[model samples]
Target chain A: MISFFNVSKVYPNGVKALQGVSLQIEKGEFVFIVGPSGAGKSTLIKLIFREELPTKGQIYINGRSILRMKRRDVPYLRRQIGMVFQDFRLLPDRTVYENVAFAMQVVGAKRSEIKKRVPEVLKMVGLEKRMDDYPLQLSGGEQQRTAIARALVNNPSTIIADEPTGNLDINTSWEIMECFQEINDKGTTIIIATHAKEIVDSMRQRVIGLERGKIVRDEHRGVYANATT
Target chain B: MSTGVYMQMLLLRQAYYIFQEVGRSLIRNSLLNFAAVGTTAISLFVLGVGVLLVINTNEIAKTIESDIEIMVYMRHNLAEEDALTLEPLIDNISGVQETTFISRDEALKSLVKQFGDEVEESVGEENPLPDTIKVKISDPREVNKIAAEIEDLPGVESVRYGGQDFVKKLFSLTNWVRIIGLLLITLLGFCGIFLIATTTRLTIFARRREINIMKYVGATDWFVRWPFLLEGIILGFFGALLAVGVLYFSYGALIAKIQETISFLPLVNSSAVLFRIFEGLLAIGIVMGAVGSTFSVRRYLRV
Candidate 1:
């Protein structure tokens, strides 16, 4: 579960990225954050991971006030929520298996656990056959799947994906969305921030729309209301 | 399994991973690792050479100082029997090791051997060289003190040891060499640290993307740091070991040559001192390497 209470963020250069944004996301909810460029969507996602603290108000994850969390505890907090970037940030030199295994390794998971879990997660992402291939050898969709597998390897309760389909073709994007839908069906809360209008309208999920640093809409089974692309 | 056994296994696995990561990164960035190792070895070698020079200089100074002898000249009219009586007085001085009485005739004979028979003929029947007691002291530092004491002895006219100004200059020279060597070692130590730090920084910068990915996946700061720290330490260890190897053989050859060419110069025997220097160099190398990596990786570890 995630909650934001009157959260606001202002950059040092005086740009307001988010303004008094308050919302609650329930457990196991698959949600879409629909917004255009410069709409504070990225900042919202960053706040969930404690990448950037709320400038004026409190944010909580699973009833814990992350704003007051100690610096040393931030990593442990991150372990509870997986993150995926638009760029598919996999280490190019590392194979898909190593990249996924690294997630478990970081948490000091036992070698036996890592050995058991990494392949299982790769299979879940449907990349089991390509697990030994380097990221450079994988297609864009496969690379993104590898990233997804890495995110899932830690068994995080929530996945915050910023523009998960930003770099993929429509067909590939849908495949990736199908993976997210499957992951959410298994009760992992999913919050995806994207500008893909067709996918949002087709998915028919809970949608929150933002424009100019403020949320203007929140709807159940929502469509992409503003179609400016 | 028992909890204690499980914990031990976990620690062992963690150590294995750390070492594996260190080796992987070293090979991945082989050029940079090589550069760091080379720089560390050269810096440690310079430091080792400075240490050897200071040690040898101190040894030479001690040898030279110990070789100094005080010549206690008998009164011009004093008989040989009476001059020999002054020997006991010279020998009784606190620092005196031994005393040898050189009769005036013997001194004249040695002078004539040096200046040929013309000097002997010039002196003719009158031998002007004084009957002197050559006094060796246990400590060269006490040479001036012993000389002063011997000067006051009965039937002794004057005592001449190494000139006071010359002795002072020699000590000051050795002290300066030691101070300068120490300063140079400190300076080169920092230079080595900086070089290793810079190389590590560059290596980390090249892998910044991998580090960023690690952070996103919840890698702790220390987890990310272990490999780099280990890499730095390895570089330092190998660098220092190589330098020690080179210094061992080269210093041995140099000492051998010095002994053969200038046999009288009291060089420090290699076996007695080189091993200690090797140990010191190794410690310095490893410490510098680890410190350099720690310092360089600090900025990047903030995730």
Candidate 2:
């Protein structure tokens, strides 16, 4: 579960990214944060990861105040939340299996555990056959799937994705959404900030609309927009 | 497997990864690494030479300190009794340890022994050398003070210490060398660190995406830091090693040449002094490397 109370973030350049926002994401919920450019979706996602500290508010993940945690404790908080990006940031030189296994390797997981879990996660994301290939050898969807597998390798409680489908086509975006749905079905909360109108409207998951650092509307099982709010 | 054994294997794997990362970055930025190492080596080399010169100077100073004496030459018209009376008065000075008087004949004989038969042949029977009193002082550093006091005495012609005025100048010059060497070392050390920091910063910038990925995947700051720190250490170690190795061989050759040509000059044992100096240089190199990499990486890690 993730909760934010009156969270506000102002960049050093005096850009207000988020302000007076309060929300809660229950366990296993699928959340899509939809907004136009510069609408604080990225900042909201970064806040969840604690990438940027909130200028004025409190945040709790699994009922623990993230604002109170020291710098040393931030990494542990991040461990509970997985992150994906629009660039499909996979190490180009590493093979698919190595890429996924690396996430576990860095956190010092056991070899047997990595060997067993990496293949399992890759299979779930349907990239098991491409394990030997490098990311450059794979298509856009496959690379993004590899990233998903990497994110899931650690079994984080919440997976936060910022524009995961921004670089893909309509079909590829659906495929990535289905992958997130499958993970969501398996009891991991998935939160995505995206500009995909069709995906949000057709899937009709919980949609929160933001405009100029403020949440305008939040609806369960809602489309991207309801006739311009 | 036993838990202890498993933990050991894990540690070994961790060590392997850190080294592999270090090796990878070193090879990846070989040009920059070479430049940093070469630059650091030259600075350390010059610093080492300065240190050796200072060490030799201090050794010469120590030898001179033990034998330091004020040579008091008497006026030629002074009687033997007046010169003898001057010695007792000179000995009354608080710092005077001993006063040995030498007659004109005795001075000529010792000069011939020093300059070979030519000294006696040049003098013939005239014995132009002046009678002298060698005044040994309790403190060699006080030679100037004691010499001035003796110079004022009526029978004494002049008082001389440190062989000639230039030898005293050499001591002061060496003190300047030491001071300048310290300042130069500090400046070079900063440059060495800055160079390493630049190389590592470039590496960090190049591998920035991987760092972002590492951070996202829950890798701790230390997990990212260890490789860069090890890289800095490796760079520093190799640079210092290059410098000290050259210094050792060059110093040995220089010492051998000095012994052959300038036999009068006394030198400290090179091995012990060089060992101590090399140890210090290598340590400085390592610290430069570590601090450089740490400084560069700290900026990016703040994210």
Among the numbered candidates, top DockQ falls to 2
Query: Tens digit of lDDT per residue, candidate 1, span B98-196?
Result: 999899999988898998999988988888888988889997777878888888778888887887787778889999999999999999999989988
Docking class of 1: medium
What DockQ does model 2 achieve? 0.68
- Predicted model with the maximum TM-score: 2
| Candidate 2 chain B least-lDDT 10 residues | B162-171
TM-score of chain A of 2: 0.98
Per-residue lDDT over B214-277 for candidate 2, one digit per residue giving the tens place of the 0 to 100 score: 8888778988899999988888889999999998888888888999998978987657767888
Give fnat, all candidates: 0.67, 0.60
lDDT of 2 at B196: 83
Error of 2 at A4 (Å): 0.6
